[model samples]
Target: MMDSNDTPVDVRLSLRVNGQMRQLDVPPNVVLLDALRDRLGLTGTKKGCDHGQCGACTVLVNGEAINSCLALAVVHDGDDITTVEGLAGEADLSPLQAAFLEHDAYQCGYCTPGQLMSATELLSNRKVGTTDAEVAEAMSGNICRCGAYKNILSAIQETRQQHAGAAID
Candidate 1:
């Protein structure tokens, strides 16, 4: 509906989430995090601080990681968004997810989803080198108060190596 000034009264957003199309009619003020969790029931994307600084609401928008809480859902219309839940296929875990488990990267697991999302983006981009310091710096945005940085770095590094090996095979 348009108002007197020819402005839209309601906004309809459509996005491709995890290779699936989703539609939502939300107000322009609704944030992407809220729409993903509250509207779409994709709760894997946590809302730790609700502020962009926390990085708990990290998600991939068009293959790039972004803090969903800081982006409006309306702005992401027509974008391809991927959450943590979409990282794995129906019967398998993503390499990063498996590596996190094998490396015991999470403690309390509150930040695991965000960590996985960030790492997924990083690994897919292949811009971050296969080094502890490089992985740590790339993953610095996602904070794990549990202080499991070593294990997290290990997981990311291992996954990178595994993917590289698979590519070679």
Candidate 2:
């Protein structure tokens, strides 16, 4: 329906973003990436291809990774969204974040946020194998133009090992 200006009215969305409740009034067509970055001021989720192919707009929706650019804001009402900014604590980075830093998993850093989000989901999923090939396949959607795949894989493996060891102990 059109408002007084003859423009489509915005829809209200309630989202749990980065552990905090957020409310946004956006046009029904607004993608989740735009809602997060443009409306919520969470710019870490990049808008790369804007098409779902690049995965640059990946974010965790209810603990699963999804291309935010492909999701409509209205459909995800009350969903828990985690941007790259939400991965860390008040003083320290998440283990995966630290591993990424220690392994130098990023170059240029534009795709890092999406990469991190994807890796986070992958690590938590028990079905995905720990082999390098497995990890690469799992992360295929996120394209790091800088070709930092080697380091990204290394970081993921290292974090997996660390977590495994911790679990054993």
Worst 10-residue stretch by lDDT in candidate 1? Answer: 122-131
> Per-residue alpha-carbon lDDT of model 1 for 64-161, expressed as tens digits?
99999999999999999999989888899988999999999999998999999998887766777777788888888999999988999988888887
lDDT of 1 at 46: 98
Clashes of 2: 0
lDDT of every model, 2 decimals: 0.90, 0.93
Model 2: clashing residue pairs? none
- TM-scores, all models, native as reference: 0.92, 0.95
- lDDT of each residue in 1-169, candidate 2, tens digit only: 7899999899988999999999889999999999999988999999999999989999999999999999999999999999999999999999999999999998899999999999999877878998999989999999999999999999999998777788779
- Regions of model 2 farther than 4 Å from truth: 1-6
> What TM-score number comes out for model 1?
0.92
